[model samples]
Target: MLSLCLRRRRSPQSSFATCVLPPFRPLRCETLERRHLLASVSLTPIAADDQFSTDEDSVVLGNVLTSDRLDGSVAPGLTLRVAEWNGQPVGSSPIFLPSGAILTVEEDGDFHYDPRTSADLQGLAGGESAVDTFHYTATPQFSQIYVLGDSLSDQGQLFAATAGTFPPDPPYDQGRFSNGPVWVEQAAPGLGLATTLANNFAVAGAASGTENFNESLLGTDLPGVADELDAYLDAYGPTADPQALYVIWAGTNDFFLPFSDPAPVIANAITNIVSHVGNLQARGAQHVLVMNMPDLGSTPYGLSDPVLSGQLSAISQAFNANLAATLDSSGLAITPIDVYGRLEEITDDPDAFGLTNVTEASFDGTQVVLDPSTSLFWDSVHPTQRGHELIADLVLEHLSDQGTVSIDVSGVTTVPTLDARHESGQAGELELWLSADDASINDRNGPFEYTVDWGDGEVQSVQGTAAGVSLTHSYDALPVVTPEIRVRDQDGDSSVALREVVIWGTVGSDRIRIRPDAGGVHVLTLNGETVASLDPTNVDRVVAFGLEGDDFLSAAGSEIAVEFDGGDGRDVVLGSRADDRLIGGLGSRLLELRGDADLIGSVAASRLR
Candidate 1:
């Protein structure tokens, strides 16, 4: 069996010489925050200098974090604690420092911080871990696959009592739909294949390169699908590997939630996944195949949307056309099933395919209706067990003992990691390390790029190669905001990590101003809040906060200044914007509101002075 292979190019910018010298075990310089239980529940004062230690089963719980080795020197007397709330664990309280910030964590287990979720806990473990060191390295010998669109792909559910495993339901029952034979099972024996040809990755209402009906209505369980795929692939071989036969019978939902930009969205997602598969191939298994779109117009969902029926058909045509072109461009050789044509034939005459009474096998003029004993679809969407088998058979027939397939991915650059600070003033920076398992890294092209929003509208960016690098950001104390960080790979693909920062100051009293001009704008900041902004809408009497503290000031068409009451008690001058003066009598009646903005002084009279 000859196989075609295309080794993509590697960027030259990251042309680093491989060096081998010492056996240095990786040390955890930054420990992740972990959740802990409280041994004793109480609202007592736990002083910083105080030490309250407990065992694993103790009622009073605390998260103890040890300082990492800094320049080979460990910080001393650094035991920290994160208290538990109720029965669960909340994040640690701020660990105030004289110079910088420090965080608390659990010392015993593996913890990873997800900038996305904001809370730190046990990171993905076991087979779920993203580490790719244990994959096989032998190239695959086959590429044939059986494509099943959705649950109705197999009609085994029709014989639910006969088949002990398959279930009978509106979505899973093959009895209601006509396409009921296990085509792959029948074809595999004739094809001389060593493994099963069918792959039922299709869930009810699934779409191509996107989520299914259930996943969207519910939610894509984090790391669930990817994690399961990883584990399954870890134990699977290309001879019968699901990867080899990329069967996707989805996109019934795309009609409902069609992509505003379908081509690129679908293309990019496929490329991302296929590139990963190539990475898998580089690790060993070969042979790859993918399925194409089915005829939803024949299904209940397609028929339901009368106005959208034509539109859905057009979208499906366009999507498949682009998909074929994209795969062709990528040098990936996949035999697409003429699902639309087949479905059209089936709908025109269900009897030809052994299906019966599918004329009403449509819903709302858009979705497909299912008829057991003949049709492949289960509902307005999805496939039956027998449908799955037919898809499998088609894939099996394509794998004749011949031809080489090559996929070139050298033009793509690989980014390895990302690092970011939690918030402007918050503790701990996030470091994300991304790796292209089998691809070469390009320093110039970069591992990726990162953009940080420190919750105060401050933005910062860094190239992917800038991993392990640190940058500082600022945040406001009031109007508590969420800190969001985004990382974009060289391919312009991006993911976000979100966190929240607690500001130490208030808003109303902190008088800051942002002056607007024809071109330029003046900004005033107090703590981390921009209490007021200047624009053409409100052209006069702008009230704002100070740059760094709680103080109020008003600006008109003149230079900005602060107001003070004369003949009153001595007013405490916190700070100033410019070289301004302040004078008042000795302590008589001077009051400053805390977290409040209330002024009793005459502004016009004091301004004249």
Candidate 2:
């Protein structure tokens, strides 16, 4: 078998080198030198009869020829017939080969071999050579992540640019505005990439367009997202790595800057951001993640003044709506992260997410909070480390949902492990701790997919890269339930963990009231104790059971349907205005009808009031 190899040039400016492989005979390792090195090489075996044809078996040579370097020159014994062979392949153009393979050469001389039908090679018979000429094209693998944003994503660029004067290291971790590593840094590991794999071009207070607001405030001009893109293009050339991930998160600072009319300000911000995405797509960026702005009005800075808070909130909503619509219409492979929704969720119910203070900043510019772990914001405008973790969680979950990143548990002897603990002080909420022993073997920090079966015919799906996640479910009827949790990696390999939990209910006689609101159904005792709150949008139905008591159940003026079971008692039940179900168990019961309701058990066993 003979092989044809293409190697990248040593010089960054140089293109590609084509090499000829010797026949299936052993050659001394020293005989092959750096000039014949190959990277990302693909080899297809030809017939021993000297005819180039496809075989059932082919050897893939990935990083096998790493020791040798290649100068931009073709070796002897091969006639390369590519279009404009002066050197570099022109922007991933396809070059058809006679051996049923489509060779695509990227601008950087990376080779991609796509095998077509083996029947195409049948034409070359009776010792005829495979091809008179050959063309080549290939795509490069995703190498690194490129980030362009404001202080939310800035690593050390602003600190270095400012000579470490602003955001002192004591309160701020290194150069970040936050108390610790930002979202991007926290997310890198989950992506199976090191922090260095992310090339961060973000700076502090960068607007969507060409201006840096923070730099201007400091009486100097620094790079914004636009300038950052230009600098990246200058360094890496116009043809970017098509497989790499590019993140663009801006527009927060745009809202912060003074503007007479928010309409034009929002329009300009979306326009600039869309323009940046277009530029990236034109330069061969295939995977791009754009994060929308969070609620600026809810920040401590905005909360200081009610009017300003309302204005900022409105502007943020308008900007996000427009940005989403614009990106959708543009028809690019762009994934928009809902930073606004995620932050709002954390703020609305802080306890559900292990957060205590969402409205106050941990750092007041002069003093730091006693425990910054539970606080959402470091300063008035920037998120603390805990907030950053949640943001990272949102990003990882989005990426996993889009199939950009996944957990890999294949080739592991030990399966993934999961542990569930009840979240303290929160009813119907459980904290799941998941980890795979195989995670570190290959540096695989996973975006693992978690499926939680609450064992009451209700299941929930959550995604995370870290070890801990929180999930909630309400059980109105059952006294106990066994919940099962499954953590699956990208390869579909999974591990299941189960825990039995006693639900919130009383065995004694109790007064139960079921009510439905716009959000969902609420189950409570007559004493105002919450039995369960079920969101119909998330769950299928709302159910409640009256246990051991001659319970008086009422579902008056309810807009949604509910189910109630009177257990071992002469119970009095009031039906809802909507479709409802009532069950009488083991005792005489009183059934009250309001709307079209279904009655269960023997009607003779129940008495009408």
Candidate 3:
């Protein structure tokens, strides 16, 4: 068979050099600093005696962060991720820093700083170790994504944007409506936009307001959908750009509880939505997305009055119908995410979505203290971070259908290893592993998908796993084979890796040999299925990936030499009786020594930092 291949560029800039490298395990820095107002500050490496200013809100720092490296030499300039919480991203701005430098600024919840790459993220929060990283980049498929709506759209930046009277919910530093990064936050990186550019102008408890104003005249004066547009315009003026997708998700409050609004009020609300879209379209917003509200009558508040809940559900359906009618008739580019259908999917069969307690609100005393990771609804209304992630997955599906996504195979860490020349007419064991143990996308505790190309006409797709999964394929009388593998998460973000193999009807002398380098790798799971997997092999040359679980890995084969990267959490890794190398992750670790020559990455090693 003839080998055919296609390659997508990582960036317009840079050279192409592929080598044996470590897996790309992007970091998930959980910034659970609830109650922080606003503090997007600077990065300045403090003196050895004072790494921090002791101030929680804001700090004074310089642009050029000067600090001594572990090598006793001054560090050089480094590239850092720039992010904003409460606005629309206007352009594809790239920051170029000089080589040979790394920057780190002390930060916590309610703070703002250029997010660091996962490789360089480390800090402390609430006396416990905390970390975060930026994993998204603008690719050819799409540049940026702008959001408009209510709490769901607002990824906590609204609190700091408005400086609302209420302190932000605990553990949510960025003013997100949920406990952690919302669906947009998790989805943006996969869609090729930086996680920081998950810019939003949505406010909590927002609704489709009257014709003139954003907030309902009869209800609280929350920022209206139109008002959200005004905020965007006020910040970045007006422009019509097709590089980014415009997302609008609102209208739950329009038909929410205390559902005693008159007919005229409802009619005006629909008009308000139309006007909002018209303003955006007039400003050159090319791709517009509108998500219909779910069954609000089923919320905690709605449940209090079941009769009203039913009415609210009916009204929500009608509101969604009216909103769709206007968008379809207006003749502008428009798409709708079936949020109404999705919520039903989650509640109708909670087990499928890993959701429990959908009917009742996650309540504890008067406080709305939800883990958000699991609970669907934090309280009466807002979804948990997990809930938001599910919504983002729906959005990602839409992006995928539009063919506007750049896949990052590294995010899933699915690497396939096989000998260069395989005997034709024979089934060769082509081993594949997906190890995204350290890959922490904002809110998703992922279960990703792995699509494998066996260099022939055969293609296979499998769900990722916690401990990892292996795939093998056989070729019969094949001429040449080139294997390519790629991974996609529920949110549709992807990374790709490729390798070529020669198929001979005879035998070969030796196989391929590659050493792992400084690349990130991790595992992402979905619905308890292994989208990202790890394998512990007792082979002569071993490449074992340790994700975020208790793993008992030991190399026992003769002449065993292993390279192991242990992920977060307590782990027990036993080296070969011959010789081995082990790298521990952000967790308590214990190693069993059987090798006379063993290498371990520890606290003193700059490589771990």
Candidate 4:
């Protein structure tokens, strides 16, 4: 466990009354749409003023106001009259609540890149708020959740990719599944703990032997992990060394690259990472979870070349085995997940694993070609929004047991599989298969909730416990249509388990439905195809519609964004504040951010609070 403390270094300075409003917005944009949207939103840095007191207790100028007066509830849009310090950038931003005495002045430093700092402004009564500027020392809790690795540690990249907003030459590139309800966040609350994270450090294309990545991945060099830790500690003092430190799904990139054996090479690098992590004990991090590399050979990237793929798989396995042995011997109490095994099931029999078709999901041979409304990939190795959710669910399951703090994460899916066929060019039928490992299947209540969104306007739903190990469903589709299936557990964790079962071959009919009998089990036919025989309490919502031109809409209005499992291939309007509604979706939204804006939609979309 790491111990952190921050000494009060800055003398509080209250400059000329600079009215700080709600809070300043963050500079990072995970989505191109958001980047464009934000581009339209003007930003003006408030200049500083220097005529105020520096007393540690006195209210400062430029400080953010989060009290009742400017707490976002201010209808008709709120405004603030902010003044600057006479001539300095070191003053705070203060606010005047309706109570008269200058309300607390908040330093943006405390809420760095988060929306919570401005939560108090969302529902504030419409009125004028005043603020002063000053600097407040930041003090973090004693716990943190560190996601350390090379560029893979960067959550921004995952966010950008999932949002289809990858920046050119991004400095924040943490492969797919790094953003949103990643394993670290999912596990924190469940374990009755709070975690501060250090995201994807495993840079894309950067491996263990790479000069820039090897040690830098752990922040161990000249401006290395040590310095980074120092900076983080200064900002967030006395916080838990992240509830858990997630080491990369590394090794694959290390071995997959043009390296031979790559075991000892990778193992040595890994040893360095472990050593760095072990040193964190002095800084406070205790629990650590290491994810073994997935079977790259089964992946679209690895499969590109049969020969290369086979070689890589062998090396990957050997490396993982060695790594596991090392971890076991270290007695570091690390939880090593068979990530490769989980992915193997999905890649091997996608039709049986509850996963979207890798072929359909890919784009341009190299990338997982996405159809925006149907496809789930933007490139060869990365995942679309839906892909990220699938991976997130697997990781979160492990996290939930850690017990940081409990959150609703029941609707997610594990390994999903899909099957579809077209009888004629006019219409077709579809079937879906999903894995049932560690599922909360119970005969008493129900195990899962299933929803079907047929491209057009047809929808179907059911709820029940699993009688067997797999869940299945069938759908009839028109010539140009895509179907999406969404499943959720009792805990609210949900996933758009499958997407776009293109039925081009044939089908006798355009529509059909199978209702479960009194016993809760039934085999159904849609357009002459026997699909699902759900046990009564397993379905939730089902709909049918034309898929080709359907767009998904998204609804907003909450602290966190709503999670939309159904991926692209439909129109989505994530609605306005009150009556917001999300339309077409191929899969659940992996991440959503409404920084300073007041959200009025679903909360599932938000990966962070």
Tens-place lDDT per residue, model 4, 1-609, is 111111111111100111112332221212211111110111112222222222211223323322112211111222222222111222344333322223332223211111112323221222323232232211111133555443333444323433433322221123333223334444344223443434334333344433432232223332233334444556556553443343434544444232223445556656754565455555555445566665545545556666645644655565566666556566554545566666665666665534556533344433323452233333444444444445555654433211011111111222222222211122244444432222322211336566767657777666644331233334453433445666554444465455442322221113323344456553333445655454423332222322333333222432212222222332233322221112233322332333332222233333222
Candidate 3 TM-score to native? 0.41
lDDT for predicted candidate 2 compared with the true structure: 0.59
C-alpha local distance difference test of each model: 0.35, 0.59, 0.47, 0.37
In every candidate, how many clashes are there? 95, 10, 41, 205
Worst 10 residues of 2 by lDDT: 401-410
lDDT for residue 381 in candidate 3, whole number 0-100: 64
Question: Could you tell me which residue pairs clash in candidate 2?
Answer: 34-68, 34-69, 103-137, 104-137, 104-138, 105-137, 105-138, 112-138, 407-490, 509-549
lDDT of 2 by residue, 197-288 (tens): 12888988788888876664455778878998988888788897765778899987775565445667777998999899889988777667
Q: Residue 440 of candidate 1: its Cα lDDT?
A: 21
- What tens digits encode model 3's per-residue C-alpha lDDT throughout 1-609? 111111112321100121222332322211212101111111111212112222111222332113211111111322222222112121323321121112232211122233222321111122332222211211123445777777677765446545642224453435765567778788777554644423576665566662211123223455666777777787767884555567777665554323223244446676776677678878866556667667766766567665656645655665565556655566645656778778878988887888767765554425645444557876556677788888888776554321011111122222222121111123234455554432333213346566768767889888764344466687654333456666554434455443333222112211112222123222222222323222223123344444455443444432345555454445555565565666554553566556765556555333321
Q: Per TM-score, what order, best first? A: 2, 3, 4, 1
Residue 303 of model 3 has an lDDT of 72
Model 2 TM-score is: 0.44
TM-score for candidate 4, residues paired by index: 0.35
Off by over 4 Å in 4: 1-143, 150-153, 157-202, 205-249, 256-261, 359-361, 365-378, 401-609
Point out where model 2 deviates above 4 Å: 1-142, 196-198, 401-609
List TM-score per model, in order.
0.33, 0.44, 0.41, 0.35
Error of 1 at 548 (Å): 99
